[model samples]
Every structure is written in structure tokens, then in C-alpha cells.
Target: MIHGSVVHDPTGSWDTKAPLDRDAHTALATAVLHWDQHTAPAPAPADVEQTALLLSGYLDRLARELHAALETLPHGQLPVRDHVAAEIALSQVRRWLDGPSGAFQGEPLAQAQSAARLVDTLHHAVDRTLGAHPPTAT
Candidate 1:
């Protein structure tokens, strides 16, 4: 059995609980940048707008999940290897937000990009935590 005081994997499966919604995330990213590729862009398609909204909702969820994963570890200690990936993902999201992509660029694209980044980081953090080898029984 997986060793941990809190068996929080809701599914009770051996695999990590956090799964990246890559399809939605990819769609959001594409929607965000699609307008830029057009010379004279028309209104965003219905699907694009919907994707943005979905991403926003997912981002909130992702944030919560990340917070929970971080809490699972001992105080001030982390699975360094996995945690590093999570950190990188967080930094990537931050960069995307602070960059022009975050400004929304007069559209939902920037916001979508920001949401995508959060999701990306969330996945990284969770993967690292769940994959970590628990402290061996002494």
C-alpha cells in the first residue's frame, strides 16, 4: 500500500490523483493566440469563448489542488525532484502572466493563457508529490 498518513487520492487508486486536462488546456492556449495570427480578426468563435470560460473555472480548481498537494508533505520539506518541476511550472505561469500574454490583449486570449499556465503547474506539482517515494519504514 502507498505509505502516507493521509490517503487523499480520492479515487483510492495507486496513481496520482491529479490529472492534467491537456485537451482543454491546449484548446485554451490555441484560442488565446489564434487572434494574433489573423490579419483582421473577426469576433472570437463561440467555441473559443467557451474554452476560455472553461479554463478559468479549471484554473481555480487547479490552484486548490496544488495547495492541497503542498500541504500533504511535511512542514518545510518537499520532494525536491518533483517539487522542482512544480516550481518551474509555477515560474512559467508567472512569466506568461507578467508578459504581454497576460494583458488579455483586448481579448480573452491573455486570460486563457494565464489559466493554461496555472493548470500546467498544478499538474506538475501533483505529479511530483504523488510520484514521490514515501520515507521507507525505519
Candidate 2:
């Protein structure tokens, strides 16, 4: 069910600061690398629904993987904040997934778009977390 690349800051927690601070060189780099808006023409309702379902599943799986990694990574290699960040980030993604995802509430398209962006952000965020501090080679 997973698809696409290019993550973004759907939760806005990536930078862990104000919008202007993102450009500040002194700011600690966030898990987010980069992101872009969806530019394609509006999709059909069916397409949107399918996309949402697929992304929701993918995001859920990715979050679980990240959560497990955060919990299991060898000690002395992780800062407490690393686990904290993973908790907060995954919580935000899960909250969104739990919403509207059940019944495709209010605006189906909007829900779908939200899922798309969340998935994108998570993709990069998870990558940043593991990539920056990869497990030691065996």
C-alpha cells in the first residue's frame, strides 16, 4: 500500500521552533529534509479514497517501524529526546489517521490530501531519524 517519496512537516514539529527559525543556521536540524505540495490536477473521488486508504496503511506501518526502532536501538547511542521526538511525531500521525479515516467524514478530498501530506512528512522524518543515527555495522 505504500507509495511516493519526498517528506514534509505536516505536524510542524520537525523544526521544533517558529517558522522564521527554520531558516536560522543555529537551529538544530530537524528530521525533515524537504517537501513539496501536490501539484497534480484534482483527482476523482474514487482515486482520492483509494489513495487515502493506501497511505493510511503505509503511514501506520512506517510509524510502527520507527517506534520499534526508537525503543530497541542500543543504549548510549540515543539521546532521550530522540525517543521523545519519535513519540510525538508518531502520535500526531496516528491522530490524523484515526480521524475521518474511519468514515471519510466532511470533505473526502481534504482528508485524502491530509493523508498524502502526512505520509510524505513521515517518510522523510523516519528516514532522518534512522539515517542520521544508523545502527552500528555488525
Candidate 3:
């Protein structure tokens, strides 16, 4: 379902273009923030199928957006490690999407929580690459 490989064109988009546009970056940031803030509550047995469907769709959309963010990376702007992490996150989401029953260990909310966490990870990486804010000292 989810592949682990990360592919990039060395002389491609980022190499020839400016950094991600402010508007695009902001939109991605907003999406990340929204997903981060919205946590899925546990679903009842009857609604499990519907909840799984919604989460699967959300994961699909988020994966596309993450790919877009990756394409917008300016050369040398973000470390290669960040990009790899984003790819891995996307793959994790994909695995859930491609699952036979779309269940994460037999729990719908658990699956959604997993996907949301992956999205959060990608969002943080993209935000860092875009210089949205300084990483807070822990």
C-alpha cells in the first residue's frame, strides 16, 4: 500500500524556481493547523464504517497536499531528512487507505488518530522548511 521510497529530481522544480509562494505556504499551514486541532472522537459501532470513510478521504487529500508541499521545496531550503520524513508519513497514510477494511487494528478512531499524527508530523516539517516559526525550546 504505502511505499517507502522518496524520489526527487535534483535539477527540477525547486532548483529552477523560487521558494514556495507565501499564499501556498499559508494554505498548507492552515490545513496543517486545522487537522492538528481537530481530533476524531471515538465512533459508535454503527458509525464505524462512515467514520473510516471520512478519515480515508481526509488522508487522501492530506497526502496530495503534502506532495504539493514537497514539490514546492526550494533547493537546499529544507534538509533532506525533512523531505524523507514527509514521504514516510505519506506512505503511512497510504497504507491505511489501502487496507482491506480501512481499520487501524480494529478501531476507527485509532486509525484516524494515527493519520492525524502523521499529518501533524508532515505539517511541522513543512512549517520549518517555510520558516513559519521558530521551533519552541522545550
Candidate 4:
């Protein structure tokens, strides 16, 4: 049984075929939420490290999925706007990776805020990407 949230077609107005976009958006939203939850505070150093590692893995997976989706698109069919949004999302993840450990080396409040911002950025990008590609019947 398919037990999960169902995303409506993005291009329903135009009656385009957009199964891939729907699936991608759903997956991206899931990842963003997972990161947000794990990144919250009150953990030991070891636990924080583990959480970071997991988030890194998730980011890597997302990158691979985005790349594959981009690869599958034909030149004309490629959603340039979506690609740009995804790129921004990827850049935000990279920033967190490169950001100083000290930046998150404060109280749980600060850490949670930073993490939340990152997750929000990711969600925004995913939403933009999903909206950028209208469903196309191909």
C-alpha cells in the first residue's frame, strides 16, 4: 500500500505529465524535515557529530538525485529555473559544511536556529524547483 502524502500535479492546470517532479518534491521535503529534526540541540559532542554525519549523507543523496534528474532532461525540456533553485539549495548545504564549527558551538537555541534556517532554505529551493517544472505529458 502506498502510505504517504500525495502531492498534486504541479501542472494540473496545463494537464502536463509531471510524476517525476511530484516525486522529487516529496522526497526533498522529507529530507529537509529529517535534517531539521535531527539538527536540534541538547546532544553531546559525539551525538552532534553523528547528526552532522547523517545530514551530510542526506545532502549527498539529494545531490545525486538532483544530478540524475537533471541528466534525464533533454536540452529543451531542462527546467533552467528549477536547476538554478536546486543549485542555490546545494550551495546553502555547502555553506553549512564549510561554516565554522564555532558558529554552532553555542547554546542549543543558536544551534537550532542555524539548523532551522538551513532547512528552511532547502525547503524553499525544493519548492521552487518543483514549481519551476510544469507537468509535461511526454
In order of appearance, the predictions have TM-scores of: 0.50, 0.58, 0.51, 0.44
- Tens digits of per-residue lDDT for model 1 on 19-127? 7676767665555655553576535656555665676556545555555666676754674666777666655544544566553445565555556556656666766
Ten residues in a row with the worst lDDT in model 1? 7-16
lDDT of each: 0.59, 0.58, 0.55, 0.52
As for TM-score, the candidate ahead, 1 or 3, is 3
Off by over 4 Å in 1: 1-36, 39-46, 80-105, 133-138
lDDT digits (tens) for residues 21-100 of candidate 2: 21221111121111112655455677667766766665666676677666666665566666566677788787886765
- Sort the predicted structures by lDDT, highest score first: 1, 2, 3, 4
- Whole-model lDDT, candidate 3? 0.55
For every candidate in turn, the CA RMSD to the true structure comes to 10.7, 12.5, 11.4, 11.6
Q: Write the per-residue lDDT of candidate 3 for residues 56-98, one digit (tens) a residue.
A: 5545655666676677766666677776777777777777667
Return the lDDT, model 4, position 60: 43
Question: Clashing residue pairs in candidate 2, if any?
Answer: 7-120, 8-121
lDDT accuracy of residue 92 in candidate 1:
57
Q: 1 or 3, which is superior by lDDT?
A: 1
Let me know the TM-score candidate 1 reaches against the reference structure: 0.50
- The alpha-carbon lDDT assigned to residue 130 of candidate 4 equals 46
